[model samples]
Target: MTVIVRDLRPGTPADIEGFIRVRHRALPYVFFSPASVLHGLSLPRPDAHARKLLAVADGEIIGTAQVGLAEDSREPGQGSLNVYVDPARTGRGAGTLLVRTAEEHLAAHGAVKLFAWVLDEPADRAFAERHGYRPSRSAHFLRLDLACAALPPLQDPPPGVELRTAADFADDPRPLFALDAEAGSDEPGDIATEFTDYAAWVDEYWNHPHLDRELTSVAVADGRPVAFSVAHTHDAGRYRTGMTGTARAHRGRGLAKLVKNDSLHRARAAGYTEAYTGNDADNGPMLAINKWFGYEICATEVRHVRELG
Candidate 1:
């Protein structure tokens, strides 16, 4: 069977649907939708030179790859590509073809180093090793049965703090952006990111198609957002935590747990049957908080990197 790679046609429904189908089958722990996929492609990232490629065999899409530079990283020449093939259609050379095409695209964009996430499974890890990629760090994908899990009971905010929803700041989300920038800088990851552009953040995150403003909880202190739990929901009755963080100054005050719990409770009440989130394997505090909420690690992926000479 001959497999060919081509750029995804954003205007074509079949292409977008195939991309989403392959992604969900390959990485079910995360959320994906036509809107989310299109939104990501529509966002401007000139420096990143982002491109989405699809591997087609016999007129059917068998694999997908998103290739781009790590534009937000403080470091230069960091390339990122994540390729996923339909689980039922492996061994057709689609994965290898997609990787080769993605690497070529990134290299043409002046990427000096390339990073990819491979599932912790033996075959996946071995494939990465064969491609000269070395494992770096791992992260876990957590799932909670919102329909039946014994979630922690909701609690009111402590003194001097008020619980709010992301919608409350809809008119002006600058404060939330400020909070996100401060808290997100501390997230554990190999690629260090600096979220300094407010307009870009607004387009990439604030107006994202999957973000659920009403279900996203925030903790306000001193009349500003100190902590927040960003929620994303799709039509499949699934809810995901895009990010949950607290300002450094408010870390010890239980604000992170407060906002997350609030968000989870509201998400469950809103008919989201499943909740999903991811955490760096080394992030003990967030892991502990998730455990307290009855989330179990369902899957893990190891980050792998390769240097291009």
Candidate 2:
């Protein structure tokens, strides 16, 4: 059987479904849907040259790859390509072909460093090494049994702080945008991103199909959002934490944990049975907070980097 790699046709429903299927099969801990896949392809950033590729064998998509440049990063020439093949379809050349296609695309876009995430398994790591990629950092995919696990009791915010839903910022989300920008800038990563485009953020994040405004908890201090936990829910009984962060000034106050707990409790009340989230292995504080919520590490992935001359 000949396996060929090509770009995904986003206009086709079959293509979108196939892409989501491969992703779900390869990384079951994360949430994905056709709408989310389409939204990602429709981002308005001029510099965001992203593409999704598929590996097809006899008209069936068995592998998928997401490739894009780190446009928002202050550092230039950094790109990323994450490839996932169906667990049932490994041992074919799909993974290798997808990687080659993604690397060529990133290099053509002027990427000097290419990064990819490989599951922390012997074969996955060996594949990266065979392709000239070296491990840099690791991350964990955590899952919580929302239906069975007891969530922390919701408490009133401290006297000076108030708990609010992301929906409260409907008329003017600029405050939440500012908070996200600041918190995301401080997030640990190989590429540093600066979120300056309000419109792009709205189209890509606020208006995403899976975003759950009612369950997304935000901590308000005085008048501004000091911390937030963004939630996204799928049609299936699954909820995912899009992001949970605290502003730099509020780091030591446990506001991040408070907001995230509020969000998770709301999600459970709303009938979400399973919850998933991921964190950098180096981020001990957030990891500990997730553990407090009874989340266990379901999978681990190592970031692999390759330099292109």
Candidate 3:
């Protein structure tokens, strides 16, 4: 059987569904939906040059790749190409074909350094190393059975701090943006991103298809948002932690834990039965917090990078 690689047609329902299926099977810890996929493709990111590619055999999509530049990073010529092959369809050269196509696309866009996330399994690590990529920091995907796990009981905020939902900021989300930007800058990762464009943030994150403002908890102190736990929900009672952070001045106040716990309790009340979150291996504070919430590490992925000559 001959396997071929091609660009995914955003207008085709089958193409979108097939891509989502392959991705979910390959990385079940993360969330994926038709609306979220389309939303990402529709957004105008000229500098990113983002493209979704698929590997097909017998007209069936067997693998997928998301190729794009890290447009928000301060560094220049950095790109990302993550490839995932359906577990049942591996060993047919689809993975290799997808990687080759993704690299070509990123190179065409002037990428001097390439980064990819590979599963921590031996075979996956070997595949990345064979492609000239070296392993970097690793992250763990944590999952909680929201319906059964004993979540930390919701606690009242300390004096001078009040708990609020992201919906409270619907009229003016700039404060949340400021908090997100500040916290995101300190996040552990290969790419350092800057969120200078509030308009872009509004379009990409605040308006995301899966963002559940009602369940997203925010902690306000000194008349501003000091901590938050962003939430995203999809079909099948699934809930994911998009981000959880505390502002610089708000650190060590237990606000991060307070807001996240509040969000989790609300999510359970709203019928979400499964919760998933990812944490960098080096992020000890966040990891400890998640473990305390009864979340168990279900999967791990290592970031790999390769420099272009």
Using lDDT, give the best candidate's number: 3
lDDT by residue (tens digit), candidate 1, 218-280: 999999999999999988899999999999988899998899999998888889999999999
Q: What is the lDDT of candidate 2?
A: 0.92
Total clashing pairs for each candidate: 0, 0, 0
TM-score of each: 0.99, 0.98, 0.99
RMSD of 1: 0.7
Per-residue alpha-carbon lDDT of candidate 3 for residues 1-309, written as tens digits (9 for 90 to 100): 999999989899999999999999999998889999999998889999999999999999999999999999999999999999999999999999999998888898899999999999999999999999999999999999999989877788999999999999999999999999999999999999999999999999999999999999999988999999999999789999999999999899999899999999999999999999999999999999999999999999999999998
Candidate 3: where is the Cα deviation over 4 Å? none
Model 2: residues with Cα > 4 Å off, grouped in runs:
none
Global CA lDDT computed for model 1: 0.94
> How far out, in Å, is residue 75 in model 1?
0.8
Model 2 per-residue lDDT tens digits across residues 139-256: 9999999999988888778779999999999999999999999988877887888999898889988999998999999999979999999999997899999899988988898898
All candidates' lDDT scores? 0.94, 0.92, 0.95
Better of 1 and 3 by lDDT: 3
Error of 2 at 180 (Å): 0.6
